[model samples]
Target: MSLDTAALVTKLTEILGPSGIIAETAAMGAYLNEPRKRFHVPALAVVLPKSVAEVQALARFAFENGTPLIPQGGNTGLVGAQVPLKGNEVIVSLARLNGLREINADAGHMTVEAGMILEEAHKIAEAEGAMFPLWIASQGSARIGGVLSSNAGGVNVLAYGNARELCLGVEAVLADGRLYNGLNALKKDNTGYDLKDLLIGAEGTLGIITAATLKLFPLPAGYETAIVNLSSPEKALELFYAMRERAGTRLNAFELVPWIGLDIQTRHGMLDKDPTAGPSPWYALVEVSQPKGAEGGLLQAGLEAAFEANLIDNAVVAESLADRTRMWAFREQMSECQSREGASIKHDVSVPIAAIPRLIAEGSAAAQALVAGIRPVPFGHMGDGNIHFNFSPPVGADDKAFMAGAEPMHDAVYEVVLKLGGSVSAEHGIGQLKTELLKRVKDPVALEMMRAIKQALDPKDILNPGKMLS
Candidate 1:
């Protein structure tokens, strides 16, 4: 436990071999850097474990030596969960553990190693005539481990559910290097407790997840995508409920986007053309999936009903694959487009589906009141109520000054969200950035139970220290 820096690196190198160990700070840039570029503390070392056994060994070593180990995947997490918090922590990278263990398309499940890229998992499932429907922006670089660990919620969460719901079971290495092989694809099990759910969203605080059994769905025949023009969030909510009543699970995504987002993207040349039907106050990018041999045009039918009821102003249903891609491009490029304007204050908060309108309205009003003209760009999965309530700086405003008001902006939005019975950290885990906020907002008994669980699972506090629960 008292080993010096050289001795620590040498010990890790011996366990993982030289090529697997990143001993120097300069070479650890990829693992050190995160999506938001927020937390930048240097690590003692970065150890890449090639196999589950190697992961167990590394965990055992870190546990016995009392070395703070940060469990990292693709390092694509927006929060600081996948990166280091304390300078003395060593990053245990699962990059080398990339492998697909098993696939059973007939049973609607597949077992994949933690290090497998989410996009690759998608491709693998597609090759077998199935689909893993968790579609996040970072799927290209985000690995399975980090996706499950962070309990990622993406566009398709309205239907297929989040990473936790898509996941059947997890195979992990506990703090004491005990391999908990609970990977199963069963639909029903009256087990003692749901440990898979626990470790999946623990953000590596409970254990180091090595592999997982993920649920798969039959490939949809086609996806009907439409960008509907909305006058306000209230209309969008009404439209969402109507679609849900009609399509039910086929209604996959209901995303809300502000017209200013379109203006920002068009002004910045990020898009070739405006993807919406035309300019409106707000837009809802609604999509429904048609399964094989099932009826098509469900989304069209629903939209026609909405039109009859005078819900939306105008809309554009994607006619071809290219149109679909372009429509999605407009929605996916929201976060990037905001950066093109200036500094942006973002909150991944959620409200009740009914309360979404109030959350955006009051949150925007409160933000503008705190700092005049702070453009509110609240958008995301409206079906599930998780909105990325973000604010862009006004034209020609100072970035530093806008960011200086970030705390109050966050306070304002979270106040609205909490008042409406919503989660402050909707999809993103409480990493180093929101640890204090979680401490403040979370119930004391829940906090105590979480602390007790963390103590029971990771007694040494070596697994992802200073993350989630701090």
Candidate 2:
């Protein structure tokens, strides 16, 4: 039997104290309004826990009472993972636990509480003359817990890897308020079943991550940034291979942007000046980092080779920090600029690195065929095969009507993605939004394993109950 709403609020307040609970619906806006603004369900209450012990207590209370708990941090997720799926669930925000526990700049690792903001983590690393290279647009407000939960991939993933790769170990709170003390910086540990891996991308369905040991690296001397103009995705792929062959791990980022992105940014006056070399069908924002005492001009030499190989036509290498900032501003503004045009149907999917060109060409064609004149705005980390395959509705199209037809458009685009052996959900894990899609595309055996693991970890089904396994 479900507890009365007032009773649930009272119980949570008793557990967390008055300052820790937000039971009023009107004041719950900040926690419920996620980045995408797609999920707006009212939660029973938003609970803020100050420490791991508090989180464990709340978890135990929720488990015993059969109250669903939604683990959240910063609320900056693109998917609906950080927000409430069922109105009866209680949200456990980990913002109050932001604190860095340990740092070993020479040993190349740091221990930080999950609620530390991503930007703050970067600052802590820089203070020690080290670096933690996860660069996403939401880093300013995105917390460490959500970043690890979603296994976020950003621009620098080409060199350092995603959150899962960057993380060494984690300290989490299990369903029955059991504390999991797994934090360590050991480079090698052939221990049992890798619980860290299991919890990293589980989307809060298994446990609440409290603290984590993240891998750090020596700070690079500087970065060589360039924006190259390409005729198509195929040529961009060629240029990418060329850069990877030359720079190897030094090639930090190779992002693909469409001509429509440029058009929209220019129309809205989002950039002070054009960042690309000239008008082209496509562009690649390629970057390479120069380590301490390493040779400079590596990116220029690589670009020169690409020009000779007929892979690139024109390029603009950043001569100053301001120039690099403007170029990145153009690439980062791709998502926000889409809203200015009108409604956009989006898919964050990934294919093999080599199959990226085909995925874009075929996916664009499929989306266009579905909604005639649909502006295809497919772009993103081409180096990693993940593309934000989004479509801007045709000119003068009603936003609601266009959105209403989104289901068919998504089906058409996903068909192409799966045919190319790509993933339907790449960096963003399945929250409430893609549970049905996960059911249809995921392998049956894999789904069964996921369900088994979910059951093993959370038997009472009180943790994000309807999400990911919907």
Candidate 3:
């Protein structure tokens, strides 16, 4: 039998005291409003658990009473993973659990609670003369738990890796309030099943991550940054190959941005000044990290080789820190600038590195064929094959009507992505938004295994019910 709403709130209050519960619907705006503003279902109550013991107690209550629980972090996710899917679930906000547990900079690892903001983690690492290189646009608001749950891949993923690779181990709360203490800093352990890997990208469907041990690296001496002009994605791919061959692991980032991004940002007065080498069809923000006691001419030499090979036409290298920051500001502001234009249909998809040119070409053509004059703004981490394929509605078009026809647009783009052997959801995991899509595209046996794992870990389905597997 389902628990009564009032009774559920009362039990939650008992477990966390009155201050830990937010029963009023009006005051739960921040928890309900995700980054995308897509999901709007009301939750039973928003509970702020201050520590692991509180989380375990709440989990036990949910399991016993058959109450659905949603584990939420900073609420900065693009997909609807961090928000409510059904109306009866209670939101468990982990903000109060933010704390640094331990740090061993020389050992190249640190243990931190999941509620810690990603930027705060970076600060802690820097204080010890080490670095945690995972960086995203929302790092200031995105928490470590959500970051690992989604297996977030950011701009620096080319050099370091995603959340899964950056994480060494995790400590999570199971469905029956059992604590799974998997936290460790070992570099190599050929033990039994890799529970750490299983939980890192599970999207909170299996367990609620309470704490994690993250990998750290030596701090770089400095960085070389530049923006190179290209004719198309084809030429950009060629330039990427040459740079990879030359810089190898030092090539920290190679991001592709279309001319539309530059046009949109400058038109909206988002940039203080233009940070490009005049106008071009496309631009790439290339960066190389210089390690301690190392020279810093790697990027310049690579760009020079590209010019010699006829892969690039024009380029502007950053001469100072301010120049580099302005260059990055242009790339980081891509998503916001699109909103300023109008309603846009977005897809976070990835193809093989070599197939990116074809994916962009075919995907753009497919979307344009469906909707006349629709503006295509496809750009992202070219080095990693993830292109944030997006489309702004045609100028002077009705926003609501354009959004109403989003289904067909999504189909058109996804078809091209799958044909090129690409993923429908790349860095962004399938939350409530893509459960149906996952059903259609994912392999049958793989889905079976995933469901089996979910059932084994959370048979009662009280932890993040109706998510991922649907």
Candidate 4:
């Protein structure tokens, strides 16, 4: 009882009206094209649902018609989770669902519809004299549903945690079209099973997140920012410990960037000026939040102590807001600057904080051994133990040939990551890109439990088919 394309489009258009449904391939390009541009499978139709009722109706129709439905938010996901896999699936774009449901500035919470942009949420919070600390590079385009779906972690994860931690509760539409009304402002609940947590990082395989109640925080009075020059990752770690002891919860961010990153960025003319303290083997960008009624300079003080201890060779503390912004732009532009070089093999992995030095040192050596002259650029959240371990091909190397050898490069780095008791995919979840890798690396018992849950929840294997689980 498979419905033809015309019939399916007609039915969806009737349910959502003409403006809500798109069937032309050209019109559906935006939804199909993901951020990474790696996944290019075209979807059968793209459905723009304007309300929760519309989402439920679309879900119900797909459930009855056996049409695979891919839930898409801002299309900013790094992995291929928000794009089509089977090519015949329908994409349910949540862009029209944007709205600020409520905001309680004093209570430290805001309830927002899933389609709202992450940057918009920040502006709303800031207007109320509060802050939403999840600051990803994609925040300009990433939406709430996709952010919560991927459980995105950014620079401030060392302070506020990931999307899952910032969310108090969520409201999602189940595979069978039932709305799970779980949104709440409560700080404590003895509720059953914690279903909200289950759905937060499920990657839309279990349900479609419609809205979420997110926790807010008092706006910091100001920030103390610095870029310190270090000899190595080990020294960065030592400086990190000293800063943590000094600032404690106020230590907002600690990011590591290699010297080559600075070189590439400068060479590409991406930065108007250097954001670091001259040249060094490594640099750690640190920030400390100053609460209202508190003084700044905590970060500067910590850097001074690190310099006195000989943990850091040189440092530059941001003297103005522009300086701070430039420093952050340099750190956030790490991924974008790679494209200017050429083909890059990337892995988002994490080990324990104490083992970060070894992880970077050994991982770099292994990658160099595999591909001679491979520019190893291991950098990211050193405080959270996560690193965007990436390698740019040698100068004047073939981009296609270098990418073709990615599998061997991936294997080499992953083996080292495994030996260090780290995770293969840290912040980014196992999308279609890592389904097989997840199956192989994940524990057998854990895999069985996941499959059992998938079967119990989405019995028809229609919700985001061939994603997260095989």
Candidate 5:
């Protein structure tokens, strides 16, 4: 039998004390308000579980009562996975479970509780002469569980890889209140079906990630960074291949930015000074890591070669740490800078690496055809083939009307992406936002496999219900 709302709240409070439960609406804002502010469904209560045992207990209770449980960490997700969909679900937050279980510098691995913030993990790694390569813009507020759950990919994915690649193993609590202890430091295991992989990007539908063993690497001596001018995405691609051949694995990042990004930032006075060398249709931010015994200037040499080949127009190499930071700030602030322009329609999609140029070209034309004066701002990880294809409404257009027309704009861009053999979601996984799209776009057999896994792991559909799967 289903319990009444009052009984459920009272039982949750009884199990986790008054401090652990957030029952008041005003106090629940921190948990309810996700990063995008798109999902506004109110949760029944927010439960702060401080330990693995607490998490297991909470899971068991929710499973037995047939109440939906949304596993949340940091609440910094762009997708609505960490927030409630149905109004009656309870949010089980892992923030209070923050703990650093162990760090082995020699072994190059750190076992950390899921609640630890991503930036804090970086600090711990730095202290040990190691580096954790997974980076996102919201690292300060994003926790390890949410990062691993979403399989986040940041700018450095060109060199290191995404969260799935960085994680060695994970420990999670299953829907039936059973703990799946899979954490280990092993680099290679030819064993079974890779359950850790399943839970890592499952978005909490299969299990609640409690802790993880993450791979680490020796800290680079420094970075050779530069921002180069490119006439088009095709030129950027040529330059990327040249740098890859020269730097090999040292090529850390290759990010593409359109001129509109520079214009918006400068017009809004968001930057102290222009970070680019001069005017160009597009800019490519490139970086190569220098090991302890290795020399720098690899980026400069590559850029010089590109210029000689007529692939790039000009470049500005960062001479000091401050210059490097400022150049990175310009790239990292792309998403936030769009807000100053007006209402924006954004899509995170990826094509084959070679098809990036075509994807951008075709996508831009389609979006422009739909809205006469729309400004296409296609930018992001060119090396990884992922583009943050965004469009700013015409100058002085009504925000309401422009936003109301977002559906056609989205359809236009997605159609192009689909034609290019690209994903509807590149880095950001499907939350409630794209569940329907996933059903329509994903392969039928693949969808069946996903459904079977969801049923086997979470039969009652109590964990993060209506997330990755519709």
Candidate 6:
């Protein structure tokens, strides 16, 4: 069943003009190389469709010829979802499909084509005096299609929610080249089935998302950001509870970072100055939003309560926008700072909010037992319970050897995560990287249902074959 590469290229060239196709292996480097650099398989060709009709034609050809199609966005995904699983598959990049379909800031919703860069969307919302609250480290390059497809949950999940929650509907091209027009700005709809939810977070297995109507919120007057010094994660959790109690819906972000993060950032000169008030074992980046025409100081009031309760001893509350930006820069640089340290084994996981402390404690201990002196840097959205549990190899340890032991490290962490009623893949969806793990840990009936839906939607298995359910 070998694919006729030459014939396939000819057909693709006909469907999309020469300008829209990248058949050369050298030219496909950007599409093949993912952020993690873990997946190296090359795609047959990279096809850039400018319109939804072009996407439909591409899907039709893929479906008719039994050729696998991997839909890609900004190529910023950590998991290998936006890249090729097999060398024979063709990558259908949505970069050219990016366009603003419609927008209504007053209605708190806007419809935009899938290829729209996330940062561009933010700009569009800001121009209308509205806000698209999904903020991620890669938002500068990540597109709406990949963001919604992966159901990205960034720092603001505490307030505005993730990509799926932020999106009202999506317009996608099905496997058979049929366009499923589900785009809408409706706040409430008694839909027969949540097709939007299914397509979203599906990692391109169910369909190729072309456009999405995203939910927007009124712009906040200001943000109160702070970095609180804490002795341990337990104290951070207590402080998070206090902040939430005080700010409620206004509490935008609650991120936890260990001392290692600051140390690495400082060592690498990633920060101009320390963002925390003073040295501590852990620091919590807390942010509360101030509504338009409302009195401020909710965060300061909450911090005062925390200080009175002895939950936190020292804290640095941002006095100006520069201070706030610096504080956020520290939190945003957590993942990048790890790369400077050394080879790191990372897990994007979530547990019951109450079980976060134990997850970190036991998970760190387990890793140390396996690799002596492994630096544990478990930090992330503490308010929502998703911790980017990561570890840097011991000082002077072999980077290759450290990565060789990644499997055992993953097993150890996932064991703890599952036992504590947590999801192994939290914000990052189950791309090719986690498909096998999903099979092992996912409930039997749930897996069956997922397979059934995938079968119904993609009967020929041409849409992102060997991903997610595979």
Q: Could you tell me how far off, in angstroms, the CA of residue 372 lies in candidate 1 after the best superposition?
A: 0.9
lDDT of 4 by residue, 1-470 (tens): 28998899989998899999889999888898887789988888898899999999888888888989888889988779889887889888899999999999999999999999999999999999999999999999999999999999999999999999999989999888999999999889996788888998888999999999999999999999999999999999999999999999999899999999999999999999998879999999999999999977788778888888999999999999999999999999999999999978999999999999999889989988988999999999998999999999999999999999999999999998999999999998888999999988999999999899889888887789999998
The segments of candidate 6 whose C-alpha lies over 4 angstroms from its true place after superposition are: 1-3
TM-score of each: 0.99, 0.99, 0.99, 0.99, 0.99, 0.99
- For residues 332-369, could you state the per-residue lDDT of candidate 5 as single tens digits? 99999999987788899999999999998899899889
Writing each residue's lDDT as its tens digit, candidate 2 over 38-149 gives 9879988999999898999999988888999999988988879888876888999999999999999999999999999999999999999999999999999999999999
Candidate 2 local lDDT, residue 33: 92
* Model 6 Cα lDDT, one tens digit per residue, 150-254: 999999999888888999999999999999999988879995898999999999999999999999899999999999999999999899888888889999999
Candidate 6: residue pairs that collide: none
Q: Which residue pairs does candidate 4 place in steric collision?
A: none
Residue 382 of model 2, lDDT score: 93
* RMSD list, candidates in order: 0.8, 0.8, 0.8, 0.8, 0.9, 0.9
lDDT of 3: 0.93
Q: Which stretches of candidate 3 lie above 4 Å from their native place?
A: none
Which one wins on lDDT?
3
Candidate 4 has a TM-score of 0.99
**lDDT of candidate 3 over 1-470, digit per residue (tens):** 26688888888999999999999999999999998889999988999999999999999998998988888888988878888887888998889999999999999999999899999999999999999999999999889999999999999989998999999999999999999999999989898999999998888888999999999999998999999999999999999999999999999999999999999998899999899999999999999999999988999999998999899999999999999999999999999999999898999999999999999999999989988999999999999999999999999999999999899999999999999999999999998989999999999999999999999989999888877889
Candidate 2: misplaced stretches above 4 Å? none
Q: Per-residue alpha-carbon lDDT of model 1 for 244-334, expressed as tens digits?
A: 9999998999999999989989989999877788889999999999989998889999999999999999999999999999999999999
